[model samples]
Target: MKRLTSILLSLLIVGSSVLGGCKNKNTSEGKTPESSAATSSVAAPTDKEADIVVIGGGGAGMTAALQASQNGAKNVVIVEKMPQTGGNTVYATGGLNASETSVQKKLNVKDSNQSFIDETIAGGKKLNNPELVKTMVEGSAAAVDWINQIGGDLSELGRSGGMSVDRLHRPKGGAAVGPMIVKTLNENIEKENIPVLLNTTAKEIVLNDKNAIAGVKVADASGEYTIKCKAVVLAAGGFGANSDMVVKYAPNLKGFGTTNHKGATGDGIILAEKANAALVDMEKIQTHPTVEPSTSVMYTEGVRGDGGILVNKEGKRFINELETRDVVSAAILEQPEAISFLIFDQAVREKLSAIEKYINLKIIEEAETPEELAKKIGVDPAAFAETMKAYSQAAASGVDKDFGRKEMKSKLDKPKYYAGKCAPAIHHTMGGVKINTVCEVLKADNAAIPGFFAAGEVTGGVHGGNRIGGNAMADIIVFGRIAANSACKYVEANGGYTEPSIVLEEAETPAVPEVKGNFKDGEYTGKGKGNNGDIEVKVTVKDSSIVSIQVTKHSETPGIYENAEKNVINSIIKKQALKVDTVAGATNSSKGIMEAVNNALNQK
Candidate 1:
């Protein structure tokens, strides 16, 4: 298409020359068309224009992008496939685990780095990087602070299944923690004015010679384009959500279920492999003990932390409720049917709202007898009855002699009984591109890849075989910032070009409009109606930044919007790129509007 346009333009120039006076024939004449055209053309920009290019716009990507920009990377570009920036982290519960954090200090809870390290290593079965683990544990507090500074809230504290203290921090809005963190980071990212390209996927890393990083090959609405830069950070995140990758890397989970965002494929991993980056802990896959019964709704471990129980068909506690998630999941897997039940009384249910959201609490088939409940969930009635009797006895005594469950006695003896099926589900991949303490990607020979770097789940060896629930959130924010700081220092020391030298001339013609919207000046804005005509949006962009957006119409129902608007707006803000979050109730509208915005912005 671009070639076609150029061809037409050249033809027009020739026609004008014949009808009007050519510069050759009218050299003596003033202000000829050919002479005017020569003066109007400009040069294209070069790859040496920016110091660093951060790929992937998740929590890790944003952190790297923000830090790089602050550290003096005159120009920074964040490439994200989704319309928004937060990646899988936006879906997180924001419950982070860190010893000696400000929250831990305030609550007077005592913990040590050694203890944290010990638990982490043991939990991951000694497959973790001792040095990277040390860095994560020691630097976690500061990471928490960074997120707070970026506008995240850590006002509420809670506990998770693997923790020894109530040190897990929750956001102000409870379950909205992930969105809040993403929103906060987006605000900080925008303030730094880092360039973010939404709906853009990095196909491959651009190499200068044999190994040193140069730039990336990106594909967007206009098709493939090369973005040149001195350094690249791969924060594209983990491969838990990709079934194919899961089968290839961790075949043990072949038939098992998983809990991961759909986009959590191994794109970053594939690119790293192409670059010959080392992958660590590839076989260590973590599985959650409980998933939603009917579907894959991920229920946070906080439910067990607050006193939920894991019962088998027999309706009795089977394993230590406070054990590490890996242990609990393994125990469930070893059960007779490879299935377990999560049971809690009504009072416990009211306290932990996660149960309802992740399960069909209302449609529960109530039973007066444990046998009946077991029968409903397709379990052995006699075995279930015996198990329930034992559990009640344990509850009465306030002790779990069989499983050593903490908070052992929260009596399951009520008039109404409930049972939900649960099995081990792979949660996260512990393997990714290898990086050093400075967050630089290590080459196959163990040398730093000069200008190449990686962070977050995309960078491996931190958690080894297993990532503690809260540690992931902290790692991305902390290490993301670390990578940024390092990239800037490298650029400054190497004396890379400060101003972008991109040459736009003689490019194949400018691409045609694959999508439609409005573009004027350096700003682009668009308004669109959703399929149901329930949600209408006005997205405004300025100077390559999404400064403001107005959701003029909301046809969305309440409660479901919890993950929609905030996620979209936050991505736009953080990436400073116009992108929309996945539509909640109105998916078509979501894609349409976001594509429209990208269409308008990509105009040459």
Candidate 2:
């Protein structure tokens, strides 16, 4: 009887293991698990397959996947390593730089492609590949139209630093542009039925024996598997978040905080390097001057573009706030303690919806008068009042006599002044794998790698040594579509699409271990680190079951925090457990909320 019982127990354990491995896959909203339907009408296999595999699910990768599908690729897949699709794009607060667009025409803003080209080349310090610059400028109008066609709003026109005209396009209310773009693209991806594999990482680009693209080796909770494909687009972002990579290339930026998403770790560059792709301008990195020193939150350049001032410890206006980011950051670094304060009035804040986020994060110091603001921020009150008076006069006269700043839009004389402490932090990495105008990844000999393409921050030469504000948006949209079009053409000319059929091996599941231990019945508060800072939550329990979870305080990004809070908190309450999945594109915030709940329950 004992022997028979042991055999039955062993059988039960094996069954449980198999069942655990077969748990539900983490997919984007509106995505289905039917692999056959997602890729093709063919029968499903143990492993995944697609006609085109995009390695990153950021703005660039999402755009490429959608464009490839529209260009006749039957099966398209987006692999994102993070819990969400929006990479660093969710953090962008700038506008899209474009010229000769309908928005520019309607707004009576005069702009030309040549002017844009010249400015871009100059901003890049002439280190940019001329061909790439021309291509981007030429396609700017079309990119703007494409965004509009896909239900994205870019009608509002503004100017960014280093621009000669008011050519930056954004949403109607001067809201942050990046999250809007990502949300629109995600909606379109769902509408087109493009399958996005969340929590999946591409391990390697599997090249066939003929030195052409074959498939991509990826890993998920289920272990390693190869997604069979003919062409791959490396739309993964840059290495701004990778301290080692940043220090390796630009050692002077050591210990600087980053404004990039955690996933911007140069995975695409590493992959391209392994594939023998050439790199360019790897040493050039850009730093933004207005990042919050403690939390690394980057204040939008629009703050200054719309009428904000940088004041040193002595309470004097320093550099021209409208200058290029590099120049402004350098000026800030030259100040005492390498820190400065961004001061603006309620009028400037009203013009920019992005400022509301800064207010919500509790980072912005509020005062009804200049002296009060200066005293609160530890600056000379008399000097600050004098600086404000001088700035208001300059704004009223449309002439910056002090710093020669040209675009003084407002006087900032309104009451309820706001200030935030800021310093220089690493922002964008301007170097990566080299690519041609058609978005084909090139080798060291300047020969195109067959069936390999790259776009966005992964491929350099577009920005040269320094990228202009707002051009990063144009670069991703223009080149992402170009990369997809080229990939589709290459696949059509080279044997067409083939259905994938590969055997996948069962591996241990990495799903958050199911929450264990009974909870004591009571309300508890906990905290966790979010994308920008800490997230605190109040948990209510009833009969040892979570009754509700409320976010009492958080410093997360605006749009992103809402999504994660709604989805993650509700899931935890519904399941009465903390094994809920993080929302796509809002992974950090979701994890932070979950961690807070866990801490609350465990009293850790």
Question: TM-score of each candidate?
Answer: 0.73, 0.84
**Whole-model lDDT for model 2 versus the true structure?**
0.80
Clashing pairs in 2: 84-584, 84-585, 85-585
Compare the candidates by lDDT and give the number of the best one.
Answer: 2
Give the 10-residue window scoring lowest on summed lDDT in candidate 1. Answer: 15-24
Per-candidate local distance difference test: 0.64, 0.80
Clashes of each: 15, 3
Write one digit per residue (lDDT tens) for candidate 2, span 192-237: 5566665678899888787788888887644567888888999999
Clashes of 1: 15
lDDT of 2 at 408: 85
How far is 337's C-alpha from truth in model 2 (Å)?
Answer: 0.9
Estimate the overall C-alpha local distance difference test score of candidate 1: 0.64
Question: For model 2, what is the error of residue 168's alpha carbon versus the real structure, in angstroms, after optimal superposition?
Answer: 1.1
For model 2, give the 10-residue run with minimal summed lDDT.
2-11
